[model samples]
Target: MEHAELDALLTPEAMTLLDGLDPVQTTNDVARVVTRLRAAGHGPELVSAVVGQSRLRHRAAAKFGEFAGRMLFTRAGLEQATRMSVSAHHAGRFARAGLRRVADLGCGIGGDSLALAALGLDVLAVDADEVTAALAAYNLRPFGDAVEVRHGIAETTALDGVDAVWLDPARRTTGHSETRRVRADDYSPSLDWAFELASRIPAGIKLGPAHDRDALPEGSEAQWISVDGSTVELVVWTGTLARDGVGRAALVIRGGSAHELTAPADTPDEPVRELGAFLHEPEGSIIRARLIGDVARSLGAGPVAEQIAYLTGDADARSPFATTFRVRETLPADPKPLARALRERGIGTLEIKKRGVDIDPAEFRKKLKLSGTEKATLFVTRIGARRTAILADRLE
Candidate 1:
């Protein structure tokens, strides 16, 4: 959105009109809403802007919940904004460190800044993009004097009186129409500069989950977080912000519950063992954090194969860190034989899962010729050096 469009969106009349309209949740809904809005005497620009915003608010609900209803967002800003649940955890880190004021570098749409202000920390939220900074100012207006949104580069933003820093360098290429992922070295403030600043002050840097681990600065706590079942982001905490004696950790959030596993360093995986009565699929956070050994130990299990993330043991052992499946039987790895075997067993419905393999599940499913009344999950992966398939039932 341009400055004038944003100004229009923030006006009393525009806000009142937006408030009176229900959220547009789908593309089909957008057409009907846009038509009704235009017919109601709203100008074309206002209708288009409001309609676009309504759709964004509906999409943002997954990340910001009810707060999305009142916030302003751009397409790219909303796409890159941190989830509210994760931001709350980030804000709590500053709160626990006794930090009262924080410099939120590269604070897109004030997502983290909002969380910080909610925790009572004064925030200086900065974004280099003019429109984004303005949108951030609007979004953070509810915080009153607690937040100051500035249009400035994070590298040059004044840091006076800031007790800590929360730097989320722009990881995507700059564009007015589209943005694409850039490498770690290409970060807006750059990882080198970000880590240098962190070395001098307590700071938390948010990076993508796939960021090169070897490049992470020493003496920091690297944490991988998974919300629901997806590995969302990796945050490296430095100085006092880093948790004591914790070098690496995985935080899994499902529903409203959180479970964390940490180690002073990466732990060695348990020895590979034969497939037992059950199979365990570790959460993405656990796999990314390389803490599968910890989960395996807790469940009295071991890896099903070398270099594989799957774990196996008795059917009774369970942990929040992994999804356990009861082993029904092993199936033939060959497609024709596997299809025939499944047909004989009366298994029709299937949930296909794979790791350490190249076959696309959707394409492979079409070749199965599935037919039956029974339903089951099929795990296509490796056991030692051999390709294997395991049919199982999901244990709730």
Candidate 2:
């Protein structure tokens, strides 16, 4: 098409071509639109024009996902920190705590605030950026007389007589870097300062899940939450984290493999139990939460090492905390014995798992020409610094 023709189509005609293609402003989504345009033979010039105009539109459409009032949080809160889904239970933790009035500091599109508002609480949602604040207001508008979205700095924003607070500091600036780390005293609209301004209220400030554990504040409950076998976020609750972390918090999203783990206090050190016919590898969440004691207590088992998450039992103990398998054979952690054991079992295509052993499965699999009609889960580890393997099967 000629330049004039393209210009002619630039009106409603061109608009119709891009209709329903409301692409998001995110770099990823905008790139996707550009890729699609490329496939349509819309050259770089046309693509650049679309990106400048349609990127934000695409981001909005993508996030909303055809659902009304789909709560959107800051990308830093969700993406940068490994959080994917904000479980209903998590949302309720803050909402049910009698937080009648809340200043959702750095409220990215109002994810948490909406939940609070849904609970019939009056919330003041604030974000630093003008565009984000506008989007937040647009998203929160349906609540009607419940949620008020504002564009301003949390440190200077007028936060008068609010009940509680939720501040998710901007971990990174747009140009990108760890540029924002406001102190509790420096908290926007300054809740840290506001405690003096008004009253001390329950606050939930989300930081990196990988944050220094030892630095955890006194009496602050640290919660590591995961959904569908993936660790999502670590939250520090100034007041209430949960009833009893119970070692593992499996946030199941219906038909998904539940995320499970044991808490730090739950780590087991009650002396290593004797090796049994079965070896169990505790799920990752359990390892992080240090819920081995809880898992052992639940499975009626004990740890193979004082520190390792691996649990052992004389009889098979079925547990979600660990993958349990019945034993078919055993050998020293050395290669010759392992090779012989595999040959005897006629087992090949080995599924290697290790808790304490440093032996590489790739190097070992190359040595064992094994195949079998029967199988077992091998618990590879160092028993008193001597490598060992305990073959086992899934506990019924």
Pick the lDDT winner: 1
TM-score of each: 0.97, 0.65
**In candidate 1, how many Å is residue 64 off?**
0.8
Local distance difference test scores for all models: 0.91, 0.59
Report model 2's TM-score to 2 decimal places: 0.65
Mind giving the per-residue lDDT tens digits that candidate 1 earns over 103-163? 9999989999999999999999999999899889989998899999999998888899999
What's the count of clashing pairs in each model shown?
Answer: 0, 37
Model 2: which ten-residue window has the lowest total lDDT? 247-256
lDDT of 2: 0.59
Best by TM-score: 1
Show model 2 residue runs off by greater than 4 Å: 1-78, 81-85, 118-120, 128-145, 169-199, 240-268, 331-352, 357-379, 390-396
